[model samples]
Each structure stands twice: as structure tokens, then as C-alpha cells.
Target: MARRGTLALGRHLARRRLLQLGVLTAAAASLTTEAWSSTSTTAAPRFSEYPFSLGVASGDPAPDGMVLWTRLAPEPLAEDGLGGMPNRPVPVQFEVAEDDNFRRVVRRGTVVARPELAHSVHVELHGLRPGREYFYRFRVGRVESPVGRTRTLPPTGAPVGMLTLAFASCQRWSEGFYTAYRHMAEEDVDLVFHLGDYIYEDPINPTSNARQQTVPDYFQVEAITLPRYRTQYALYKMDPDLQAAHAAHPWVVTIDDHDVDDSWAADVPKENSPTPTREEWLARRAAAFQAFYEHQPVRLVSKPSGPDMQLYRRFAYGDLAEFSVLDTRQFRSDQACGDGRVIGCEDRLDPTRTMLGEEQERWLLDGLARSRAQWNVLAQQVFFCQRDFEEGPEQRFGMDEWSGYEPARARVIEGFRRTSNPVVLTGDVHVHAAAEVKSDFNDPTSETLAVEFATTSISSGGDGADVTPATLIRLKENPHLKFENQQRGYAVCTVTRRSWRTDFKILPYVVTPGAPISVRASYVTEAGRPGLQEA
Candidate 1:
């Protein structure tokens, strides 16, 4: 009866998660300001080092408020991944003020940072005004965290004349410095979208690191255990530039292949040495997901329940735009044709293959149909459009992304018709590109269904050249692909009622500490139009 009751409870939770589409409205995320019962207020505990080493962040913003995140990490690189915190819950205080100086305090609260969650705090707030900027910080005893800036979305269906945002992905710490993020921190954007590969799971070589920084021996092995994953996140989060970017804007994030493993699909792990059994893989996945949640600014709704976590959700920014952030990795079928670049593979065309599971696909289409926003955006990982690798009649495509799931790609393209203007923002290709989503890739003149702006990496491929020989060939092969550049950078978009303009921001070098950023190219899609044009 206990097992049956647990099964029933799991079914109930699944139903609840399925019903939650636009989580901003569906999830009751607000946390009470009352002190947590577990928190002790007798005396403030002291640490030998600063507790806010990992820094503060806010994300998943709504009209009323956003989730404020901070982890107490005095000894950030502790092997146990506990951040040197004692095995108990510590009382943490939070303050939301209208100004950075805390002169106009709006909301205040006390929450407990539990050792189970690596002494992390996610303060979900509400009752604040819409379409306004707010400053927030965490306090542990007399030590206060750095002031982080965040903003709430405008009211639902409210008239928003303009919205500016930046999207970035694929920052491998050992490869290069976070110079792009340092520049991104200065951008006057309202939001930031991190389309995954946030942390590379592979082992980092201390001697061969591009940044010439000292890496601990713990990172010499792949992050498989809970503590290893936590330490990996700490290493990435320890970057001041990354912290600055997080502090500057409210980020909406989703993971890709590197967040877990290379080209892992559904319950399947990638082919490699010392392959683990299915059960072991799930445990590793749970650890990775848990560590991801503890470090990110995502809400409680995103907390992982074992190997599964509810990550795919929608967010609306007034009547101007709506974003449907996707989780392509968690629910996708195993890659077809052996999961690599392949030609003449009929398995890719199998109608049963799915990029997003049937449920998420349904949710996406339904959301598109019901959306009243002027611009509907699919902020997701992986390339959405087709790309033929070799410049010849015999075409080969990467099997890991949408190109491998042809039927599923077609269905999503068909769903684009439900909205007025459809735009796809993609990552993980490590090359900046602007492509028109054609109804049929075989024919170059096929009607444009949507436009895709794929941003380059933050620092994944170090010191990328401008327009490599392969890039030129790819652009020539795929005419639908307008522009392609092998550079480390991000894409910034300015959305208005009339048009949405994207600036491909590029950095010359990331191996070095400071590199100047510039716009490589700019594309604009006018309202009611679905193709890209020079801005």
C-alpha cells in the first residue's frame, strides 16, 4: 500500500508539473517573509572567510518580483562542496530596495540557508511594482552580500514600447577568460538569456589552461558525484565577470548537452569509456541537476526531483513579447544514425522521433496559439534549422540537434504559423549565425516561417578567427544561412512594437583578460514579417 501510495503521489506531481506551462502565473513561488522555524536568531555565526564568494543573482522575473539567489561559500572550493559551512541551517536575511544604497527599502525577509542545499538561498518575492528596477542583497550576520540589480517584467499584456535583452552560452572556464561577460555586464539590457553548456563536464587540464590560472586537482576528473558537480559550479561562479553579468540583469537559463554529458539523449548516456549502468547514470544526472539548481537563480519549481526537473516554462513580457524557454536535452529521443554527422540516414526522417517530448511540444503549440504578444520567441538550446556540413550534393548533418530529428523539426516549424512573428534564439553551435527558417530546406525559395539568431560562445572555442574557410563554405552551402562567424561573443536584441533588431556582439580574443567587443553584424525583422533584413 505504501508503494502504491507513492506511485499515486508521483502521478499527482507529474500532473501538476504538466499543468504548469507559464510558471509565472501557475506556480505559487512567493516565500513568506516570516522567519523560518529552523533558523536560530540567538547569535550571528562568524566565518574565517567571506560567505558571499559565489555572489548574488536574480532570475525568472515576473511583474511583481523575481527570485533572488546567493550561496554561502566561505571556502568555495571545499572538496565536500559544502562551502565550508557547518552541517546545519543558517539564518540569512534579504533586502529589496529601490536604490542600490538601501535608502528606499521595499521588502525585507529572513530565510534559512540549509546545508542540504549547499547553504544556498532562493528568496521568491511578490507585491512589488511592475516594470521597475530593484536592488537586492543577502545578509549573513553583519556581513552583507554585494548589491545586485534586477528588474520585474511589465504587466501581462501591458503596452511595452521596447525591451532589450542579451543571450549568451557555452562558457568553458579552462579555455578562456570571461571577457565577454565583463563587457555584457555593462550592456543596458533588461534581461539575459543563458542558453546552456553553462559548465563543461569534462576534466580540466591545469597545465594546458588558456587563462594560465591555477585549477585544483579535484577538477582533473569529470564531475560525476554531487560534491564534484558542486565544486565545478563554484569554480565557474567564482569568476568576477560571470558574477557581474548575473548581478547586472535577471537571467533566464536552460541547459544543453555539456551541462550533463556530450550528446546525451533522454535516459541514454553518450558512448564513452567506463560506461555506467542506466541506474548510475540517473544518479549522476540527479547530482548535476541539483548542483545546477543550487548555483542558478531559478525558483523552487525548478528544483530537481531525482533525475527529472521541470525546466521548460514560459514567460511573458507584456504584450510586446513572450518567451517559451525549452528543455531540449531532458526529454529528447536518442540521436538517430549513431549520433554524429551522417548522410543518407533514413532513421533521422522517422516520424516517431522527437526533439521535445510530445507533452512539451503540445504545450509549446498551445502557448503559441494563445499568445497575444507581437513577437513570439523560442529561447532554446541547439540549432533549430537544417545545416548541411559538407559543401556538396551529398549532404551530411549533425545528429545531435534538430537536424537529426527531421519530423520533430517540421512540426515545430508548422507551429510557427500560430503566431504573428516567430523567432528562434539558439546556442551550442559556437558560431554566430543568422538564418531564415524555410518551409523546405531543399528549395532555397521556400516561404520563410521564422528567423533564427544563433549566438556564438562566451569563451568555449578560444580566440576564434573571423569567417574561417569552413564558415564560408557553410554559408555558401546553406543559402538560408545568411551570416556565420567563428568568434567568441553574444547576441543583443532590442525589441520594439515595429521591429526586433539583433546585434551580433563579438570579441576578438578571450584567452587574454581584457578584449574589446564590437558588433559583427546586425539583423532586423519587422512586425508581421518573418524574414531577416540588415538593420
Candidate 2:
């Protein structure tokens, strides 16, 4: 284990050195020019299989434009993790139009997909009309990829009537089918927010796995290297349902613990028995972040720099809504009281202990204070309101969630008071929860500062039940918690100037290939009113 850690650290340091020397940049430039100059590459490179097998996507929409993404994965599940691409860079062309047929071509450009970046293309575009829907596609040789739909956000502070969106998270491919995503793709929404656990880093057991799809033997081991992480992403991206969700709408994403490792904290590995050093963990984090960026339809600004990636960002849908997407796992202090569920952990209430770190906290608070939007949305992971696991006077809470960082949670609650209608869209917990964020958790009658709708998982657990004994206990303990459901699904939200309504879309079963979806519960909060009411 020590030897492996040392080797991983060595590889990471070597890459850092090359980056500092600008060798990687210079080599990439030379390769790109050479690739473009090659007669075969410039003309039409032939391929045995369709290159865009993983499908196309767009995300991070602004008033002007959005980021377009596609990976040239002729053999998506190839163990090598290069997506069966050649060693050289490949030129990928993209086109955006007002219609799906491309009759009204608006933007056309070419980008180089280098082997070092897993033959992925992220085309950041601009100069587009605000609040307009556009259709985009990619071309390689004579093959044209699937046409994807994307919409630009309304002009900043512009009066908009309504904004429709769906938020989902925690889709463990090996555990269950991605049937919820198929339903989500069919929803008429302007945006989709993925609040983390995009890919599980744990090893797979196909024989026992719910999906029972054939996979490489190497997938039985945890993802630690760049190639391993890339391969894991490839496996997940190969799902048609997931691809449909990405193609159907633009997504705003943030990372959670499962994206890298199960319950991993900043610079701290969850497995401490054969504990990895900080350097080793950072190296692993870098690999995970790189794979995440390569796979997602995110902008270049989110590209990982070693272990760090700047993912926390804000988006405005005119003056109607403002989204404060947060990265809770990246810069957080290690879980207090040694992590996990606990009680009487004094370390949790420490004023200096933070969940967003000092910088992101300041940014969130500042953005909340300065925002003019009618709805201030915190698109994030984990339960934002107090969730007491223990039923009676014990007062047990999850150390890994906001409940463990009471002071930090309190500060954010104060920020919620500054906004018109603060709504928190959360994931991470497998069960759906609708709660009213109170100014004081100890007193139920205290002012309700905001409302939270924590969506259930896409498939993480097998087929979940509608309710369990644990669910009843949780509701009994937390009076502010209005509802709870243990079903695999997502949340569809419609935001207007007057009110915000969230419908919890649930799937009865995800163990099989197809499952019908239904709205199990619905909650709405009015403008200038923070608490949730049955819709």
C-alpha cells in the first residue's frame, strides 16, 4: 500500500512539474497543428464504429451561449479508457442552429480532441440571443452526432414569467437502472441540476449487480487512476437513458463525496485503516476531477488544476430566479467527531468549522445579499435543514451532512433571510425529504427562513419503499420536516414570480429495465413566504 501511494504521488508530482514547465501545453499545441495539417485528418478520417456513442450534451447556459460536449468513444467501454481513439488529436466540428434541422445555422466551429483529454470536446460558445432555444450537433468525417436541445438563460435581471427545472443525483449504475432519467428527459424543463454522485468510485460486481451488464474484470477494483476514472465514466455515460437526459436539457452540476470516493473529505480518505497520505488522496482527487470535467458538459473554467477545480458558480434566470450552485465536498473541513452519525459532538458546533470553507461561504452570502431575483435557489448536495436521526432527547445527526456543521448551517440560514424566497434543492440522501428551514431548529414555531426539497436518488438503492419505520421516526423527531418518501426519483420544480412548486417524481422500481414514474408528492412556497405548503 505504501509503495502504491508513493508511486501515485510520484506520478502526480511529475505531471505538476510538466505543467509548471509548460511542456504539456507546448506538446499539445504541436500535436494540434500537426493533426490539422495531416491530409487524412483534414479530409475525412474513417472509423469502424460510430464515434459519438456516448452521446452529446450542453450545460452552463448564459444569456449569450452555453458549453457543448461530446466524447469520441467508438468503443465506449474499452478498458484502455482512451475510448478506442488513436494517439493523435482529432478535429471535431460543431454547429448550432435555431432549429433542429440546421436550416438556420447560427454558429459553426472546429475543436481539437486530443488523446490526452480522452478525445472529449468542450465547445464554449457565445454571441447568442438571450432566452432562446437552440439545437446543436457535432460532426466527425461524414458522421453527424445526435442533435441536442439547449436554451440560453434570460438576460440578467430581466423580468421572466416562469422557470422550469428538474434536479437529480446519486445514480449508481451497477445498483439499478436509470429509469428515472428517461422520465426526466421527457419533462419540458429549461434546465437540469445534478447535485453530485455522478459516478460511484467503488468496484463493480456485474454478476451480482442489479443491472447485470457485462463489464471488464478491471471494473471490480476501485477507481484511483485517471484511466480507471475515465473508464468508470464511460460505463455510466454509455447508458442511453442518462444520455437522453443530458441531450434533452442543459445541466448545472456540483460534486459530492461519491463522485470521488464514498464519504471522502477534503484531503482525507474514507478508508483510514490502510490510510492514504494527503498527497496520495489529492492525486486521486485530481484524477476524479479530471474525469468529471472530461465527461460533463461543463465550461473550461471548471477544468481541474491538479486536485482543485473551481466548480462553485452562480446563474441568473432574469430577475425571476438565481441559482447558487455549491461544491460542498471540495473545500469542506473534515467531518466533525470523526465523521458518521453521532451525538454530543462538541466539535460540530465550533464557530470556525465550515462546510463551504471561508471563501465559498463569503461568496454565497454576498451573492444572496446582492441578488435581486424573486427566488434565490441553493442548488446543492446534502440536507440543508436540521435532520435529527434519533427520535427522542438523544439528538443524533449525520456528521457528514449540514447537521454536523451547525454554525456554518446557521450562518447560511441567516443569509436565507435576506432573499425573497430561498429554496434549497438538495440530493445525496437516497430518500426524498420536504422540510421548512426554521430560524431555530429547537423551536418549531420560530420563523421559517426557507424551504428545502431533497430529491431521492435516481437508482442508488434497489427498489425503495414508499415509507419505512425509520421514515416515521425521522418525521416524529423533526416537526419542520413536512414529508418523506423512500422512492428512487427526482424533483421537477416550476418557479414563477408568485410561487415555486416542486413535484417529487417517484419510480416504483428501478431494478428492472423500465419503470413507470409518478408524482408522489408536491409542495409549494409562495413569494415572500419561506415555508412549504401542500401544492
Give per-model TM-scores: 0.92, 0.92
Instruction: Give the CA lDDT, 0 to 100, for residue 470 in model 2.
Output: 94
Worst 10 residues of 2 by lDDT: 27-36
RMSD (Cα, Å) for all candidates, in order, is 10.6, 11.3
Relative to the true structure, how large is the alpha-carbon lDDT of every model? 0.87, 0.85
lDDT of 1: 0.87
> Using alpha carbons, what is the TM-score of model 2?
0.92
Question: How well is each residue in 151-211 modelled by candidate 2, as lDDT tens digits?
Answer: 8999999998878899999999988999898777767678999999999998998577898
lDDT of 2: 0.85
Number of colliding residue pairs in each model: 0, 0
Predicted model with the maximum lDDT: 1
Query: Tens digits of per-residue lDDT for model 1 on 366-386?
Result: 999889999999999999889
Error (Å) of candidate 1 at residue 102 is 0.7
